[model samples]
Target: MKKMNKAEIQLLHNSIQAEAIEAMQKISEADSVWRCAYEKAPDELPPQEETEKLALLHHDFMTALTLLAVLEKTMPRNSTRESLLILSYEMFKLTCPNTFERFGCEDILKSVATLLDSIPTPEMLTAGSIDKSVHMIAKAAQYLPKIPIVPKEETPTAATVTVAKDKGKEVNINVGLHAAFAPIVPRLTVFDLSVMQAAASIYASGSKTFSTNQLYRVLTGADAHTRITSKATLEAVRKSLDTLQATIITIDAEQQAALGKYRRYDWNETTFKGYLLPMTKIETAYYSGNQLTAKCDCWRIIDTPPLLAYSKTIKQVATIPQKVKRLPRGVSATVNNICIRDTLLYYIQLNRDKGAKLNYSTLFEAAGVDTSDRISRHRMRKAVKALLQHWQEIGFIADQTDVIESSKNDTIYIS
Candidate 1:
């Protein structure tokens, strides 16, 4: 498509702003409709008979927002587009204050303002202007809600559970990659990390794609013994996927190879930054009149050297004794808990046959814990204690009577 000129861009911006204002006005009018239909104010809960109408209105509003976002994508990256985004932000602030806060519009506004400031005037525009324009566009796009259009009367499929045998199954994660980049990028919640691991595992199994339900099952570890049939869990997984998609990770030349080589080696450093799961696509499908199905293509991980290296390391470590390589069953129920397990396993593997007593701080850092925060320090201490207990249980350590010493300086010693 041809890039939009200044005039065309401004016209489009004005059109979208006017449409948004009209929509807000219509929504306000809908409040009166609700009052008449249900004999209740907009702030009050509707009667059962009007609930469907209210739901339909909500769905329509969401669809409108999505369309507005789609429209924003068509415009050229310039002051005009930025102005439209700002106008949209203001409209949301007025019409849907709760939605604005929930979607983090404040941060989006700040980011857009920063990008706009960085852009030079047309007369002073250099080759770098094109790059800055692209950056500004992407930064603005991040704030747009990528919410799937939920169909009414959709029923989710039964969650699928795939349990690998504990004897041979091993999780290989790049301790170095996560330690280096996670603190710098937006910090993923424990559940988000779990979803990422699940996706990684699916990719490692030679599958390029997996469904959101598959992710939820892997995350919940639902089995015959433990059934995790929670709608909330599925919703949480979806939300985490949204957050992961919006998160942008930047890698300079220095950190590129250290983290991993990109699949697209010819990235325009002026415009491009490292994104987790770059080039991957997410598709939502509705099949055979079933619930909306979301799937992620993780082919990008294959090209990522860090992930590949981590997977290779995992396979190699799997050959070691279970006492050293595997965490005890039930220890890794969550992402943070699993981090502790993997950290200890890596530490033990690093010190194998050397009998070196690695420092607690080093292990904690290697485990991907952020030690800069006091709460994180406390968490690390607890993780260390848990690891010690698990080691004793697995006979990796001598016994409960074995004396693991700690110095006054807070360094732990493992004999």
Candidate 2:
């Protein structure tokens, strides 16, 4: 095919988008007709012949949308990621959707996936396609999860990946080439997730409220070597508590009223989630330990005059899941070099003691890997293989000597 100029590309884009909307309308009409015909029937499934037609229509719709994603990625944009994140927010405002729905991040995944090419090889997927997106994306991602999210650890992360092409195939070239952090401020972590779980689990133990030290013991099993001693780690625990508390995720009317009764801290907005929104304003709190020296013990020693301390002591924001095992006492300032999707898989399957087989499709979608087309799916599979290999190498998962099958919709044994 000959190279098409920008105008030609734009025309093609408009054409495909029209086709996609037309297909979507046809599907809707067909479904309405089928449902009306079967309104009295108990089951909603269409007849086999109708099913086949619906499938074809769905395919056409998706193909057009996916093509649009690929084409839009090539269009020139004036904004630079090097510019201020706030300024990028301005550009995003000019182009992004005017209004956002409360639930479902589907639009974002498609847009970002469009922003990143759905290539034939894994090479591009792992590379820094997400780099420029971070400045804009982080600004927007913080607002996406205002509602309850399953396995909150699955929150989007921006981790740079670089895969080497191997003799007509892609291989585990570079999984962690940059520090990984989700766009949310206060910097939630796998460890913080466990602490939340700990707080939730302890409610069953008849504790109305829990202390950071209590969570610390549960996380590290009270091992003297791993005891929580450093302020860095202590702050991590504190931040997680404060963040979860401020978000008010539990959704009780009583707690809703008490939101600003006590001073609150505003979380900085930045994220790997698919959308963009400016961060909420900070509600300042007065606390003495804000700048404690490395060896300060003011937190441990309650003041004689009785201080109204700005502490991270959480008061039951959520319930529990399995807490992370063998957590480190102090957190390293160095950013974790891991894939965002890998982080999700690891955190959710962290305690799958007995290995389980998960379909590649399920993992692919959850990890936010693109699988819109055959080429994208092919690249996604290779990326998953590389990810699994990294897991085994890092001892996060047991060795998977059994390789992922080249066939589409392969299942992998995750341990």
Candidate 3:
């Protein structure tokens, strides 16, 4: 009587299982009533006591199952829940010291039955009643000197789970107790712990054959919104799981090849796509503006010869000869230089708008030089080179592409 022997524990374990199974069946029937009502006249269905009773039944069944699992570890194989009832009754009659010492109960069957009857039926399952029941459970361990041992050391091994390829990757397919009970592992509830044990058994098999969608379905729980909050965290997790970069190698071969051709050059995609192929440089272009300015690298014109010529004409028209003679020598020299540069800039501007390749003759013609002037092509080429070199220094035209080669007769084409 000092301790309930293995036989007595087995009998108690079986009794609890039988009672739990019966309660579960009754709970199922109660659920069916609401389901039928929902299907037939859902709009007219009212909240009722039967529904409440069903909930309580389910709650009690879960509690009983957890206890039975604990007892099973200590009990014999052949003992049934009915046998447990008989044995407890007999033990109580004999005043068994073991039963009283361990459970601190002289009547185990009577105590268990009393506890089961205390469970609230659906009608009586108010918030307060539920709270009371939960409190009773928290204190129930006091009824026994030693709490039932629930195995925590046992874990599912890799061999038990069956993994299969899902989009060419392995996944867990374990169906053991530990895996099943994973949801409740973090809780203080005994039912949760029991589920954890069950899951451990199933988890042994490992991952199963599941596509990305199916895997999501299996792992996703009801409360996803409460778990994932920030966009950054979600994005980071997604990137870690994604196989897109590896897959892209096979999918975008043509793009890769095209990119490889220009990989050595210092051009990015935008330049290649828009202007790389049509890039060019021009050599001998006449400027016909007042100030002889050169165009820069970005295809901008600075000065031309025509403008210079116009300014000179304006000066001659506005100033008298006496006033001009009164001016200093330095001032006159400066005026002359300005006139020349402006004339050259004007001529360049005139040709810039046209598609023609301008040379000295073109400049002379645009400037309206007389036929008797008889300008040599050689002298005109020198003038053009000076203008291009000036522009080159300012980076209007890159020096590397705008070289004035005397060997090519000083004629220029955009490089």
Tell me which of candidates 2 and 3 scores higher on lDDT.
Answer: 2
Q: Each model's C-alpha lDDT? A: 0.41, 0.36, 0.31
CA RMSD of all predictions: 22.9, 26.1, 41.7
Rank by lDDT, descending? 1, 2, 3
How high is the lDDT of residue 325 in model 2? 31
Tens digits of lDDT, candidate 1, 1-415: 2333553333333333433444465566676676786554656667764556554445345434643564566543643545555665665567666655655766546543432232222221111111000011111111112212112223211111221223354211111112122223234454454455455444444333345554544444333233334666667677666555444333223222223333234323312233344323332322211233322211122123222232242232222332332333434444455555554544454555554465656665545556788886776667667667767776765443232545544645554
For each candidate in turn, the TM-score is: 0.34, 0.26, 0.20
Off by over 4 Å in 2: 1-192, 220-225, 229-231, 250-324, 327-412
Residue 355 displacement (Å), model 1: 4.6
Tens-digit lDDT string for candidate 3 (28-146): 88888868766786687546765676656665555455555556554545655445445445544354445345444433555555433322111111111110000111111111112
Per-residue lDDT, model 3, residue 204, is: 18
- The weakest ten consecutive residues by lDDT in model 2 span 301-310
Clash number for each model: 0, 7, 89
What is the C-alpha lDDT profile of model 2 across 1-415, one tens digit per residue?
2234443344334444544565688789777766765776747665777667666565445545555555667444542222222232333333333321321245434433332221101111111111000011110121222223333355423222222233464322111111123334433344443444444333333222223554444433333234344556556666655554433121112222233432244312111121111011111211222243121111110011000010112121212222223322232221121123323344334335777666766665444445688986665555556555645665766885345666475667766
lDDT at position 282, candidate 1: 30
What TM-score does model 1 achieve against the real structure? Answer: 0.34
Give the 10-residue window scoring lowest on summed lDDT in candidate 3: 126-135
Give the poorly placed runs of model 1, Cα more than 4 Å off.
Answer: 1-198, 212-225, 228-275, 278-306, 309-335, 359-383, 391-415
